[model samples]
Target chain A: MSATVYIPREATALSLGAQSVARALAEEAARRQDAVQIVRTGSRGLFWLEPMLEVATSAARVAYGPVQAADVAGLFEAGFLTGGKHRLNLGPVESIPYLKNQERLTCGRLGVIDPVNLDDYRAHGGYAGLTNALAMEPAAIVKAVTDSGLRGRGGAAFPTGIKWKTVHDAPGAKKYIVCNADEGDSGTFSDRLLMEGDPFCLIEGMTIAGLAVGATSGYVYLRCEYPHAQDTMTQAIATAYAAGYLGADVLGSGRAFELQLRMGAGAYICGEETSLLESLEGRRGQIRFKPPLPALKGLFGCPTVVNNVISFASVPIILERGAQFYKDYGMGRSRGSLPIQLAGNIARGGLVERAFGVTLRELLYDYGGGTRSGRPIRAVQVGGPLGAYWPESKFDTPVDYEAFAGGGGMLGHGGIVVFDDTVDMAAQARYAMEFCAIESCGKCTPCRIGSTRGVEVIDRLVAGDRTAMQQTLLRDLCDTMLNGSLCALGGLTPYPVLSALDYFPEDFSTPAALQAAKR
Target chain B: MSERKRVTIPIRVEPGTDLPAAERTAVLEAVNQNRALEGSLLPILHAIQDRLGWIPPRTLPLIAYELNLTRAEVHGVVTFYHYFRQHPPGKQVIYLCRAEACQAVGAVSLEAHAKRALGIDFHGTSGDGRYTLEPVYCLGNCASGPSLMIDRELYGRMTPERFDDLIAADAAGATSAAATSAGATRA
Candidate 1:
């Protein structure tokens, strides 16, 4: 019998040299004349410990990592094939504290199954949701999602059920279900993680969405940066089509549903629903005015259900295990688990999928193990580039949508980027305006002109030129952008700038304070 | 920050450069593959860029003619997208993450190092046309900060030293490949 070895093929692990490790293991095994099978799986989200290797033992899968190609020969010498003891051995993979603590409802099979193999996906209870959804009526399916209390994980936190209901109820012969896989936010890779780790899960979720919304055609508007995910999804889509999971008469249920993959060309604004729709139509990715929301008229002037990758991916679990089951997990209106990506300067940075109400301190300290630099963590930016910078005093805030909002923060896409004491809050504030300036779709005056002005004001403030007046001007500019922009791209850019100015005033006041003291 | 500079540069058509008959056929084939689909402009442009290294000015008319759209309409999309280059790229394209997440972990200095080492700034190709450096917002490898992508392969936890090694290795590979092709020509 051949020994089965698991190595992650996801982008993060691949970036860390997982391919060379796989090759080294294969070469070592062949040199020893031993038969071993290497299965490329998705990352388990323990990024600090990747190129993580797992050897299937009789009792369980033994883990070893932060492994490199150079360590493969040493691993073989240590008899790691039969779960032999080594310096890098991490015991059972499941027992890793970083991974074991999380509630992985949406990310349960992330690193467990072969990404491209359909049979492996099925063996792990993959299609149960679609199978269960197939027997039920479309309205019932919508009700199931609604009752789950799931909201948009793409930062808006709008009720997912309500959005689906609108598309389901909207009178249209040709409604479209567009999966927003254009994850443009920095420090947010949960969407990319899920798409690369379990491509079929996203496919199944989109299929279930198609069935529920009575839509025949679905498109995944993926970003061009995720080449690995794009390839994985393209392959998975073909496999789903071949296996009767995607085409017309899906699973012999006589329901027609087709899925296609479309790549976005380097436009951050395209993550906006209207901009995404326009980009899909092969036009400039500029934001369109709302009132006739995307639900009513979208994608070639048809009613459409545009959802984030995580939002659609969370549907299968809702349908598989009743709505009450998913709703039982989270607190308040924020139901189910949030896949929080812990990134930037953290010791044990990875994906932490926990239910809402988990405090920021718990994620920052317990899960992340503090900053990688061993210095005091000055600020942690929850959400993405547009998210607010939370000071140490505000770290006690729970990871709920309303709770974060109340504390002048947002749980946008659950991406938390930690910064140590060496961070410059003033630079971060300036960057917020600059990022908005770069990515704004130019349709709105406040976002387009205001952001560039915001950058100038911040520069003046940072450079000690009229510091007091510039601070007030910066706030006024933020308000204008917050109220006057068309989409979140322009609207939310103020969060980071204002929060940085509010939390770390010392960073911004240094040059001014020095000048004042000199006087 | 200067009231958003909107400079509309005229598209430069290099005179005396005609699309090869075979390349023209390939462009038409690409157009034909996607012309039947709704909103085929982006896909058609991507297909042409994929077959040919970049979207040549000559191919735009062929694509416009095939898709029944005006040349300006096609040109607008090509220019709107940052990924679509008007000229051919170098042998390798290095997309360095310039976003805040990467900036938190020495990406600024790393960017400086990359520019100095490559002797090129963002969107500039090296004199030998061996490498082109481009700025990317993020590569979704934020957990491992200071990430970069060379063509399709992503590299993380990058430092100035590691970046230099990568460039040297790529240059060596290019040199060897050139040697092999030159030897074949001599034979």
Candidate 2:
């Protein structure tokens, strides 16, 4: 057997030239007569180190990167195959603080094994949750998830168990598990990371959800933006079916669950649950009125359990490790780990899955190592485009759901995009409204007309109009949007807009105000 | 279990489909293949778009006819989503990320540079039909932004200089670039 080398096939890695690096490694090894086995695995989510490569030695897998095609010759000369010293060599893979410090309960399988390899997945405790769930009653499975206190990782922070119980108790012989993989958030990529890196985990998670809610059919509503993930997940689903982990009888347990992958065309409203169900039924991606919550009537009017990718992926661990074990990791009502995607201008951006109490300060400074531009960090946007902009004053805020909501910021998918002093908060506020206008489903008046008006008002404010008047009008518009819109697209757009106006008032001043201050 | 039978949606050239023979056949095939699947309209539209570059105007009524849906129903879905293009697109479509993460990293300047270099505005195709520029919210490459995708290929940490080079390389049919390696290696 030859020495084994691991390289990432994750979209981020490919974007940063891992495919070229893969070809380079193969070409270089052949030229040097050094036979080696190269395997393309999922990313470890330490994106700053990608296309981060690892070599399996006698003791452990030694790490070296960020590798490029040009460095292939030097790496071979340095005896990288034998774990030789090189400037790019970061030593062992596990010693890196980003990976070491993470509470990787849900993201543990990422980059550790071939994502499509069922045998490798099984070896790494993949099916233990399913194996355990197969024997238990459906209610018991629901009780375990409820007891674990896992809330929706999709930003709403709704308890997963209660949602499952609603569908379970709803009197229907036909129920469906719909995984919301329509991750359209600007700064969030945790769902894309899991679907591309640890795909089988999502497969297992959704399968378990089917059993819990008595649903025999499942569909993953993936956004068309993530073509790489679509390919990987489609392949992984096929592998599971062949292995009897999916379709008619899962793992030969005498239970039936069929899974399919459905693609969503570009529509941000589809990320909203009611809108998501409408899109799944082949209609215009419109929002439905919400008296009959999706738990009761969803996805073709069948009782459906709709979960975010991370919410479902977190289930296997709770079932395998027991509710108490999973519950013990976090603070307050938030149990288990949240896969926080540290993105944007941060120095060491990647996925950091920590328990609920982790602070934004720790993630920004300690893990992220501050801005990549080496400038004074000005603002951070937690969640996606809809999340509020946290000024430097709020950096110490913890990652708990209630803590964020208390601060007028919801932990809607944990993604924090950092910006330096060069950022224009007023401009960002304009964009928040602009994005809403562009993606609105046109189902309501407030979101549709108000967003376009919000942009016009902000433009007037930015163009040195009556400052106090414009501010009041903008606030009034945001109020209408928050209270009047049917879904979060219109509802949550106010968070970023109002937060900018409130916290960064200096950035909102008119030219007259600035000149008056100078005088 | 039986091999699932496909649902056949018969084509009606009601108001007359003015498409070329090859194009019409491909559209018919896509709709017929996906007819039996649940919520198959989106899939059918995707298939037609994938094969013909855009959803041609003539194919809509035929599609509506086959799916047992009205032209209004099919047209509503096609126009609702940003991904579907009504007219034929250029050889390459560039989805430039204009969202906050990309904006934080100088995407505003990058967007300006792209517009100037391509001689086209957002959603505009070049005179030569070489490229079409589209403003996208995010390409899921936020950490390495400014991000953009040329067709299905993703490019990250884009600068004006690198942008020109990538366009040149892509024009030459090269699949890779010098990849401004996401800034220097991990510290």
Candidate 3:
């Protein structure tokens, strides 16, 4: 028998027809009785063409994809076993534009090795970070992460190393490491993609965190929206446990760190770290006050390191390769690569991890290839629902946190949603308040009640109350939500609402009937 | 043995919603089964739609009851989520992703085109009672933007022209089935 091949059984691959491709390759290998093995590895982030297949050649592993089962026979006949090609030639998988352009820090091992095979992960540079981390003083490791300039990728851009150090220093007998996989943003799926595409990186990142913080337990609070991700991560965790990479006395270091999966109920508020902690304790998810910040009194009142999947996934690489290597990629203050999730109304949408400071023009025109409708671009929502809306004129804004912030957009989770000319900014603004009203944890007054009132004001404006006085009132309402709300949910809701008013005033002046109010 | 946790919180009911028992049970079942899911609200609502065909007002309390959650908790989930329906949906679901990705690609015009051709407003059912339309955020088919989900299958890079053809074909399919179902439901 030839060497066994394994590939990802994740949903993205399923959606891309990996099942049929794998089956076809198997049948072809069988017919020839060739001693060749075909493995279905997880996606390598080049999701543009799926059914992406890789072959173990004598020279290097060759890749081909967006392949149909119909093409398998031709591929086999074309000496594909020897790296020859039929039609689906993507020449060295690593060289593909989508793969090569990415400065994959967190997703480095994804789509590269067999997710189920621990041996494969080891061969391709897995667990190296954990070994390196274990050898160092926890303080040294923390210093390296802090110097790397990595921030939380799950909406909030809090410095990850600072959070870890706080939890590490917090006085507590029991501590915890929690991976927030509760990615509930409307235009975001990077967390799910990372977990399913490269589960090990996250595991390694969490293990490193546990060791750094003297925590004995870690929990991955994954959202249910990603059923496939949940199953894939669970399997990866099991494999890690079996191989002694996790569980008691990991890798003979005598360091005990146990990890478990805590599924979240479908509350967007749960994406907030403290609420996630409460949910892990098996209670209803509601946002808690800050200052006690999760690092001090989190997860059953024990010091906890709560981080998003991407932030934790970034740790292993920083530990293994050192902070300088990671720090070399990004621009200005945002020193590291960001796995920017390109989504919504664009021609080409997918994850693009580049050094920060890429312009919106590049993201939209060059990478996204303009709108799918071949129409004029209108507005873009940078960040998630709580992020700001920018008109076409503001496309010059750079993606760095400071730059985006200066341009009135917070780089929340790096989710950029493009809109074409046909968009009604007014209606989209209304949706912002509506979404806030629906998702507000109701712990704060501004978010709990202001969101509903905000929606009504927008509704009234749309219903022909576009008088100058009324418009001013609407603007004032947005400011209240902006300043008064506790979290970004309320604080940033005005970004979209106000931006719509500022850039698309024509949309606000309700048809002729509504214009009468202005007169 | 794991201890059962008991927690209680007050909840508010929406202004107007009084549904029957069966509908409530169906909604609750969907919510309870899915509550523990990370980002579960949308999928739970989707499940409720699959089970009971619509989201009834009473489903909120029922969901609260089963999950040991408050009425506001259930209400927040049901209303916060865009997928759930407080009223009955028509036979087929045609949800368009209107988030920036789709909009950047022309989903706005397509939505207008769809609404005009279908003769139904956004979030409204067709007059013939065959299709219910709704707006969604994103489906993660970013590379193929301007996408729509008919039932659960994502159709990407859609244009008003292509959607017209799709709607025509769908209308043809709906007509034959509607003829039979309409007769049965009305009769």
- DockQ, computed on Cα atoms, for candidate 3: 0.15
In order of appearance, the predictions have TM-scores of 0.95, 0.96, 0.79
lDDT of 3 by residue, B26-68 (tens): 6667767877664455456667766887777756665565556
Model 2 residue A127 CA deviation (Å) reads: 1.0
Number of the top TM-score candidate:
2
Q: Report lDDT per candidate.
A: 0.88, 0.89, 0.75
Please list the residue runs of candidate 2 whose C-alpha ends up more than 4 Å from where it truly belongs after superposition.
Answer: A510-519, B1-18, B176-187
Ranking by TM-score: 2, 1, 3
Candidate 1 iRMSD in angstroms: 6.3
Which sections of candidate 3 miss by over 4 Å?
Answer: A1-10, A28-36, A77-81, A85-87, A513-519, B1-141, B145-187
lDDT (tens digit, per residue) of candidate 1 on B1-187: 5698789997644321367886687787887898777788888878877777688877887777677778888788788777888888898888999887788788889999999998999999999998888898888999997999876778889999988878777766753321211012111
**Model 3, C-alpha of A335: deviation from truth (Å):** 1.2
What TM-score does candidate 2 reach? 0.96
- Candidates' DockQ values? 0.32, 0.33, 0.15
Query: In order, what are the TM-scores of chain A for the candidates?
Result: 0.99, 0.98, 0.93
Which of candidates 1 and 3 reaches a greater DockQ?
A: 1
Candidate 3 DockQ category?
incorrect
